[model samples]
Target: MRRPIEFKLRRRTLLAASAASAVAVGFARRGVAQEATAAARPAGPETSTVTLTINGRERELTLDNRVTLLDALREHLHLTGTKKGCDHGQCGACTCTVNGERVNSCLSLAVMHDGDEVQTIEGIGSPDAMDPMQEAFVEYDGFQCGYCTPGQINSAKSVLEEINAGIPSHVTDDLTAEIAVTDAEIRERMSGNICRCGAYSNILAAITQVAEERS
Candidate 1:
């Protein structure tokens, strides 16, 4: 049978529209598959095993290659005392002693320090017997809210060691020798540790008092 010219034209248009819809759906599904493939790819080279000496105990942890040392300590080991004020190493809240030198724990990665000694706030003292620095902080009221106290005490201990080792600060006249710990010296050296409680005056007093007693 011969169909009308208008009817034939309408049928052809419907077929073309159906084909176009099917093509669009196929592209959309392919895009979703590509996204899933990308997400399923394994993490790159930075992931590995790390062994650290924490609080006089040996511990092993497996972490992503990009995990920061601070995260390894806090998230992996459950040591929450080390606060993360600024993960960019700007704040010293995550400060810890590494081989007798204090460093911003967040600045380094866990995998970078294999067989390294790490000392966090919990490692330094205990609730039953507090370390001298902890006691000094408490007695002098060096902090309020106490978020930065751990880093402050750890940094303070290192500052005294640096002073005894003849390290110089910005206020030092000679760069080659250990600098004395005056009020200004303590202030300048301990500036890396910040307390939002406006406790600078008391913090300086605590550090100065402890330094003199040790001397």
Candidate 2:
């Protein structure tokens, strides 16, 4: 009887085959992952260039479209006076004047206001020369922690402007008639701003003093 030919596989060959298979599988997975990542990537310029007239000065900035006006001011411009509280447009800590009107900066996108005018707390006053509203706030102790003082002062100024401009608020009794700067009017207009320090009474007093002085 003819002896049967026996074939044996080398351990080194088996190990090399296993390693090659693992390498091939790894390359396949890497290629798939790269394709998925490329597909998920967003197309277009992620940043936009906008020119804003902030505090009576022209400022040109190239910023991400997703950045809010508040972030643009506080982060890019280095104006930290506009506080970022809540960041949901609920707390008015990020309030600022855009085209002479008070707006929640957090709610506005920087790219949307390409050629808009903005006024922040820094524009309102300075340490050496404070605005009348700022002075009143100091006199009446309108703030405790002072976190919301900048927004409070900004809103207070706009409140008077709104009343003077005949913009009727919710509490206005007569829309056709001239609006009065009553407590209700002030409260209704200022309801958007939230003061966690519970200094509403003092804030009211401060605003009232400014109103009276202007009147």
Best by lDDT: 2
Residue 9 of candidate 1: its Cα lDDT? 87
lDDT of each: 0.89, 0.93
**Which regions of candidate 2 deviate over 4 angstroms?**
1-33, 42-45
**lDDT measured at residue 26 in model 1 versus the true structure, 0 to 100:** 94
User: If scored against the real structure, what TM-score would every candidate get?
Assistant: 0.80, 0.85
Q: lDDT of candidate 1? A: 0.89
Give the alpha carbon lDDT tens digit for every residue of 1-215 in model 1.
45687788889998999999999999999999999999998757666888999988999998998899999999999999998998887779999998789999999988888999989999899988998888888889999998988899999999999989888888887777657788888888888888888888888888988888997
Candidate 1 deviant stretches above 4 angstroms: 1-46, 176-178
Residue by residue across 1-215, what tens digits does model 2's lDDT show?
23322223465677889999999999999999999999999897699999999999999999989999999999999999999999998989999999999999999999999899999999999989999999999999999999998999999999999999999887788889988888899898999899999999999999999999988
> Which structure among the candidates has the greatest TM-score?
2
